[model samples]
Target chain A: MPRTSDGRERLIEAGVELFSQRPYGSIGVAELCTRAGVNKGSFYYFFASKEALALAVIDRHWTWQKGVWAGILDGSGSLLDRLRGLFDATAQMQVDAVTGTGWVAGCLFGNLALEVSSQNEPVRLRLQEIFDEQIAMIASRLASAVESGELQSVADVDGAAKAIVAQLEGLVLFAKVFNDPSQLDALWQNSLALLGLAPARA
Target chain B: MPRTSDGRERLIEAGVELFSQRPYGSIGVAELCTRAGVNKGSFYYFFASKEALALAVIDRHWTWQKGVWAGILDGSGSLLDRLRGLFDATAQMQVDAVTGTGWVAGCLFGNLALEVSSQNEPVRLRLQEIFDEQIAMIASRLASAVESGELQSVADVDGAAKAIVAQLEGLVLFAKVFNDPSQLDALWQNSLALLGLAPARA
Candidate 1:
């Protein structure tokens, strides 16, 4: 639904679903074509190869995810509240994957990051930029929180953001490996500790 | 050097090198056989499938790494000193990988965990047990530290250990993606924060 243009959109959509559900190397171009209802010739017409289609899929998913994160990070409530909202939404996505796919699909960028970063330079660079942006997103929020005098200034807001993002990916790994979404329940508290804050009273 | 036999040891060593250098799905039996200098016939005699060899490789790496960790952890100055020793040794491995192999070979279990958790149940379960063991190893250290009053008792020792492991994995992911081991430099400070302590000064 995000990138639907006759054949091209279909290929991207198929890539997203398949790539998220399993390792990128395990999913073949044939299966992607079949799932998209497009033949090999048409698949070639739209994209050069599976890796090309994969790059497109990464862009498409990041586009959608960035928006979702933006909505939550910019939404109502305090900075901590908004951060928790983002974590909740992330955990919910994994939960939904389990409900719909019978397995924890994990974070798409992270799954690809581990699976293809060394093998594919183009994807690896793109993912690096994406991660930088992800850290920046949170870093920007922390800057705002500091400006407003919400609390004491963090010693290094960017470092805090980077640490927080790393924590997110780390816990996501646990969730995927353990096949349990609740593994992410620690994100909110761990994040507060990283920011040098006490856990919020319930 | 570990689990050394005739063809079997060769295959496991090959698995460690190849699997670390590239994505698991991209590597195949033929190449593995070629690298190990073992023919296809003998390869089957040693392991039933590629996944089987992967399991052997996972066990072998953990066995070796467990010793490295136990040595530093059990022989160090204080609990904090031992923990820092472990983190330093972990980072040094990445640096050594870059020096020896020209790429950061990440934690083998983590690489395999994300690459094959959904497709392979055996590896998933084994990785789950390995992660639990890792968390437990740190929790035991924290418990001893608490008993000595070196620090106040952590509110949740297990939870703190889990968070620290998650942080390590997360930063390792960053180091791998960014292709820079310095991404892990924050591990010590961030880890201290996770354990509800301020950063240790020089």
Candidate 2:
């Protein structure tokens, strides 16, 4: 079994699992403590309140996603390949994570954004920051493609990047709702086609 | 102001607001009663429990959405025009509803699907049924287009319909996150383009 000596780490792991299962507001401190295998005192010692623990969970997700973006952006390939790689990697990660949990609960950030964006300003702002960062990353990559003369000058880099993000996020939601991996495949092909880069089918 | 004579209508209206603002599990019966301005007895008289109230809310939303679908399906115009009209109408409804609510809460069924799909089988099944109905409606429309030679038979009607539904729901989630209406415009145009329909801008 996996183990953690630090109360903060334990709390975060428990928070991710529970929050992904249900909304953060529905999770109580007692249940969190029990899941983390820590007493209430230890939980309090690590986080001041349930909201704080939820924030830590969001931070953990952000950190992991940033690492994912880094991989996609750093790969030495055509811009379209890199973009397709991002979607493929996301599909694999989602399948692995959901399979391990024995249920497909969808993207945690997307799920939380739907539930709390209107109700909590702090959470909403944080989610926006993450989304903005993602958009900028895609924009930067596309801008580089434009600078290299690989893409048309009138390609509308910002617009294309935003659409790409929207479509990718949209496809993830579809995958979750339908519980089908082929939906992701269809989306992957459509996205690449939108970018004018789908591979020839055999 | 609009008015309802019975307690059940009030409870459902309150539920539409509260449940959309947050997850069903997070909102309590007392809070819903307070928001609806009805007593616990009245709430119970109308519905047996919170879950029953949630089911009622879902049923109401499904009923209302069916009306929207009928408007598009029954319209006399080119298939492309009818599809664009559907998106245009939906966008207007979203803007009007957001202004009336003074907040940017998204679709209640979507919020519920994300929150309860993994943990609650009944809710998941209900959501799946609604989704299936939506796909069927779109597929039937596309079939008409195929008959008229507006779209090629090479097009997978079911796949295209599912993609459109995914785009619409995804667009709503993105719109909520960005707090912008322009995202809906992008979704509207791109989704039509994918369907081989005339672009919304055109």
The candidate that achieves the highest DockQ relative to the unseen native structure: 1
Task: Give the TM-score of candidate 2 (chain A).
Answer: 0.86
DockQ, per model, reads: 0.52, 0.37
In terms of docking quality, model 2 is acceptable
Single out the weakest 10-residue window by summed lDDT for candidate 2 chain A.
Answer: A193-202
lDDT of 1 by residue, A1-202 (tens): 2333688988899999999999999999999989998888888888888989999999999999999999999999899999999999999999999999878998889988888888888988999999999999999998898888874637688889998999999999999899999999999988888888852111
lDDT of 2 by residue, B116-171 (tens): 77766677778878888988998898888888887663267776677677777777
Q: For residue A101, give model 1's deviation from the true position in Å.
A: 1.0
**TM-scores for every predicted model:** 0.96, 0.86
Q: Against the true structure, candidate 2 has what lDDT?
A: 0.74
| Positional deviation of residue A111's Cα in model 2 after best superposition, in angstroms | 0.7
Instruction: Name every residue pair that clashes in candidate 2.
Output: none
Clash number for every model? 0, 0
